[model samples]
Target chain A: MSDVLAIAEHRRGELRDVSLEMVTAGRDLADQTGGDLHLAVISGDVDDYATQVNREGVDAIHTVEYGEEFNHDVYTQAIEQLYADLDPQYLLAPNSVNGMDYAPAVAEGLSLPLVTDAVDLEEDGGLTVTREQYGGKVETTIDVEEDHAAVTIRPAEWAQAEGDGDADIEAFDADIDESEIQSTVTGFEEVAGGDVDISEADFLISIGRGIDEEENITLIEALVEATDATLSSSRPIVDNGWLPANRQVGQSGKVVTPDVYIAIGISGAVQHVAGMKGADTIVAINTDPNAPIWDLADYGIEDDLFEVVPALIEEFGGDVPDV
Target chain B: MKILVTVKEVAEVEDEFEISGGDIAEQYLEYDLNEWDDYAVEEAVQISEAEDDVEVVTATIGPERAEETIRMALAKGADRAVRVWDDDIESAGKLDVETKAELLAGVVEEEDPDLVLTGVQAGDESNGATGVTLAEKIGFEWAAVVNQLDLDIEGGVANVHRELEGGVEELTEVESPAVLTIQSGINEPRYASLRGIRQAQSKPLDVKSLDDVGLSADDLESSLAQTDMYEPESEGDATVWSGDAEETAGQLAEFLRDKGVVEG
Candidate 1:
């Protein structure tokens, strides 16, 4: 039987949500291929993470104790060793920053075919993986000929694997060469003092490049004050030094699931949509009626945001915040 | 210091795409340099400019038309360009990630630069594996999705800040002879100046065949094939409000209140 191995990720001693999602994806692929699903967790205290990842569909949990935090070199080496020992037909990881960082190195070391950011997967004679291209505008199904493959599943694509399983926890030691690790994590620096987390906010008023000048940001702030909404922006606003990086909402920024998401002057690019698409209600204000954001928005106001925003502020309360 | 940058030309499909056979129709498609790669090229040029005796070279695997993309890199500040393509490589059709990585690895072997930089992923495929795979194939330390970078030529290390989910940034120090896949917003990519463009036309651009890289059709065989392509399903219809600013705002406020997004 073809066995599948899933790499579980943890941060700050807590299992990330994507880890369970990977288990779900692994279970489905294993069931399709008539194989067992094994999971690998590499961390300093493997026992802490093992129970969290021990789900019903999992057959075994393999632990590699390296360090508490994620070490790229250790992960690459551990996965390479684990793959050789497990000899799984498919190796799955999350299509996250951590997963994408080390999965390719493992794939290359093993000479295995790699398909990343797979949104969907099906196994017929071989594997057919679905991925989005051109910024999620089009979807393409890729067929892999290799029997053994390394794949990274996109986050939030699959439901988290639930139920309980009595999967046996095992420890595996990898031969990691200390000298080979040329990079070391210095520390994590919070981009904007970590003061504002837009992802947790209930209401958000987001700006984009269409805001034009930096001085105009005051108008959005006035609306935010009136609506009692948090202030966030697209990548351009952050990149332009108009706002702090932490206030950005997009793929590289924050994945926000607010109750009300008001997008101002933002042309919904796929990268930006991937972050805030989970919002309950979306309102878009832009001059361009054909903006992609309008498609995802529940309500669209086609007009100059400069003019429309002031009116919105007046409608909300007209209490402009000090510039 | 020597920097090698990888660039790709992607099809810019602005309108509704028609599918012929299993691929999108190319009649209405316009090709341009991948948007993300522009930031990569700009980062490489900026890094080279900060150091003395730094050489920035660009390489791409595409048809003759791809030279325009390579020229764009040179116009922005790269020293030279190399285009890797041949009849056999082209005839094989869409090569998978491994084949593309191998092809790029071949060029890296030839140049043997101190640093390799590429866009995080191509806009067309968006696989995001080529740079990391190339690093592994050529045995270089690497980092991916880097938004900030500082190179120490003497110490042979690069200090970088990588973007992560939830607005967290990871700081790492990687040794030189490394590969870095650049993320967008790393820098403001400069436009090609008229004089720079004219000079880029005269810059040294060399085209190499697969044979030159010691690769054959078999070596370039794809492990993954595109079986189908289609448009994503639309979610739902949006209510468009057409009116003056005050009227539209009032309507929007009313709708939000109805949806319980704002106070009544």
Candidate 2:
């Protein structure tokens, strides 16, 4: 049996949901390799989090404490020291801003294959990972050709495990220097009203450049309001000053896996498509029938979104319950 | 403030890529500088030409042919060039993006650039993880999809505008020795002039290898998961119901429900 290390993600003592997703991914991989799943919580005063993350499937917990919070250098050095101490066949990290900093550094330092933005995991004798590319227009399966691999699971793609089971917790120490931690995180200013992590959203209505005029966005919002769904979009729409980048879904944007994804007037470019194809059900409303979005969409409408969206708003607004 | 721009020679996006046997077929494809990296080159050259104390260095990884990508950079206006040789490493997509990022890190660490500019994402593979990854390796602040950058080097800080969905955030302060992954529309990439191209070959083009950088060969290899790369399935021909915008809209709605992208 091999061993797997699941890196815990946090901001200001609160654990991000993606950290749970990484643990879930770690468990899946551990099952595949017939190894023990070890969750590594790398934050200062991580004892509380260590006990909290201790679950049945987890074989052990490594709580590495250093600074009061995350500084990329400290975390990177911590992970580097951790891997050096307890080698794992696979290291699972949450694909977050934090992971973005340390994952590659760990891979580079260790000279290991580093796969970022993985969406799904299948446990075989060796794990096979699925990642969307060219902005979700294409899905590619990655098999770790090496004996050990490092992967950053895209947040919100995997389901977070929810249960009440206390497993053994181990407080592991990595002798890391404050000086070794090269970069200083001067501050952590949370995105106001941005606390809603899109990756965990089960329902989403994403717009694209095809939506064109921002005036029509209200009609789509009406449709969203009718469903009580979150409104997001592609990069172009964000680029046009139509939406916030936080709300963008695509390559170069946030990847989402909602239960229901509604695309209005989006052509489904590969870059834009990579972000949301993981949704359980996708519906696209656009005037262009040939829009690439229809390629994977379960339902596609070819019409002027101006009229169709308004009709959807009108029909669903009155009859649909606020979800 | 000198700018070090890193670019790579990649298959053009518009060209059809062959995904045979689960690996990208590199042969018979027209090779060009990566679309985003070219943008990095363009922005650097433009900034260097406009501002004093700004010299742009075009750096790349690959074989002799990679010089072409750097030559293009010089044509665009980089004052010098460096090619991380070892064609052996480039051929294998086996070189993890982080390994390449490390190489870039090595270059930047040596140069100690005031600003390290790169494309937010590349067209091919488009992993786009390198900038942030490299920034961390070298201990620099990184901002992705950065649309605007105003730097005060001696002040050791930069004001960068990052594009967000529907809105833009003006970040007033990020330290120097930072990495900015520029978006495509931020600046127009320039075409190299004939004179610039000729002079580029005469300019200094240094080549370094993994051995030269003090990294073991294993450092070039990846320990993390390897991608069994494959082209995405081609979307089947779309069903078209053409008519006026009104009629078409109705048909479209009907089709969407049938497809399950919308409520019936």
Candidate 3:
């Protein structure tokens, strides 16, 4: 039978949400192909992650205790060896920074076809994957010809796998050659100290390039103060040094699942959307009626921010600060 | 020191695209250099300008019109450009990531640069597999989605700060001869000046066919096929509010209060 292997990712000793999401994706693929779904965890302490990820639909959980933090050399070697032994027809990994770093090497080393950032996947006589283009303006379908393929699933694209499972855990030996590794992780550093963590904020009032100038950021800050919301921004605001990098929300920044996300003066680019699309309620305020942000927003207010912010402050029963 | 950067020509279609004969209509399409690669080109140029005897070369695989993209790179301070194309590659139809990576590897072998750089992903396919696959084929250490890069030319290693999920940043050191896929927002790209654009026309842009790269139709064969191209189904039926600012804000406040987003 053609079995499917999913590589689980964990960071800072906790299982990443994408780990469960990949298991769901792998399970669906395995069901379609009439094969078993196996999860491979390559971490120093695999039991904690394996115990947490041992969900329904997984046939077995394979553990390779290599290191505490993610190392490119260790992961690449482990995955390559595991693939050869498992002989899985479909291999899946999360399309995050860690997954992208090693998945390509694994695919290339094994000469397997790879498709990254797949939004939708299905099997209709052959494996068909759908991906976005031009900032989600177009969708393109790709059909993989090879029976064995590697795919990276974007986070939150698929529903997280649920239910408990009693899949047996097995110790896997990768026999990693330490001499082949040429890179080392020096350490992890926070982007900014004493900065507001926007990802953890329940209500975010984020601004973008439309803020006009650095001084205009005060308007968003006043709104945040009035509404008990946290101040965040798009990449332009962070790149311009108006806001700290930790406050930026987008693909290259933070993936936030805030309860209420108020996007102000932000034209929704796909990269930005990928980060905040999971919010429970989204409110967009922009001057352009045709802005893509409106497409995903639950409420759209098309107007100038200078006019809207004062009114919003007044409406929220807060004193309007002079511009 | 030599640096190689890869740029792509992508179609900029703001309007809804119409599929004509299983492909996007070419008439309404306007081509521009891939946005991500622009940052990569800028990074390479900045590095080259910082050091002595440093040369920056750019390569692309596309139709003859792709030369304009290469010229754009040259205008931004690339020393030279190379275009890899062949009739057989075109005749064989759609090129998957593997084929494209192999083609890029062919050019990398020819250049044999000290470091290679590419955009994290292209705008069209958005697969993000080319640079990594090329690194694998050429056996180079690699780091993807790099936002901050510091090169130690003498030590032959690169100290790169990679952006990860949840606003995490990882500092890693990779030995020289590595491939780095540059993420946007790394640095603001400089626009080509009038003089720069004029000078780009005379810069050397070498064109090579697949045969010259020692590849034939068989080698260029793609394992992936495009089944269809269509518009994504729009989600969310946004309720647009129109009125004077005060009235709109009052309405929004009322709506949010009704939804309990804001305390009354």
lDDT leader: 1
lDDT of 1 by residue, A76-151 (tens): 9889888889899999989998888998888889888899999999987699999887666678998888898999
Candidate 2 local Cα displacement, residue A283, angstroms? 3.7
Docking category of candidate 1: medium
- Each candidate structure's TM-score, on Cα atoms with residue i matched to residue i, is 0.91, 0.71, 0.90
In candidate 3 chain A, where is summed lDDT lowest over 10 consecutive residues?
Answer: A188-197
Note the DockQ of each predicted structure: 0.59, 0.25, 0.57
Residue A19 in model 3: shift from native, Å? Answer: 1.0
lDDT of 3 by residue, A1-323 (tens): 38899999988778989999998999999988888999999976899899988999999999999778888789889989988998888889998888888898899888888988888889756789887766666678889997888999888788889999899999997898988787888888766446567878888888997899998777777877788888888887887678878788887678899888989999898779878989988988988655678789998788888999889988887877666
**If you assessed candidate 2 against the hidden native complex, which CAPRI class would it receive?**
acceptable
Arrange candidates, best lDDT first: 1, 3, 2
For candidate 1, state the interface root-mean-square deviation in angstroms to 1 decimal: 3.2
Task: Judge candidate 1 at residue B216 and give its lDDT.
Answer: 83
Over 4 Å off, model 3: A192-203, A209-230, A240-242, A255-260, A265-271, A277-280, A286-292, A302-323, B15-17, B243-250, B253-264
- Candidate 1: list runs displaced more than 4 Å: A194-202, A209-229, A255-257, A265-271, A285-296, A301-323, B237-248, B257-264
Q: Give a tens-digit lDDT track for model 2, residues B134-232.
A: 876786766666666677667777666664331323343567778887776566566788898888878888898766655666666654444565545
Candidate with better TM-score, 2 vs 3: 3
Highest DockQ scorer: 1
Superior by TM-score: candidate 1 or candidate 3 = 1
| CAPRI level of candidate 3 | medium
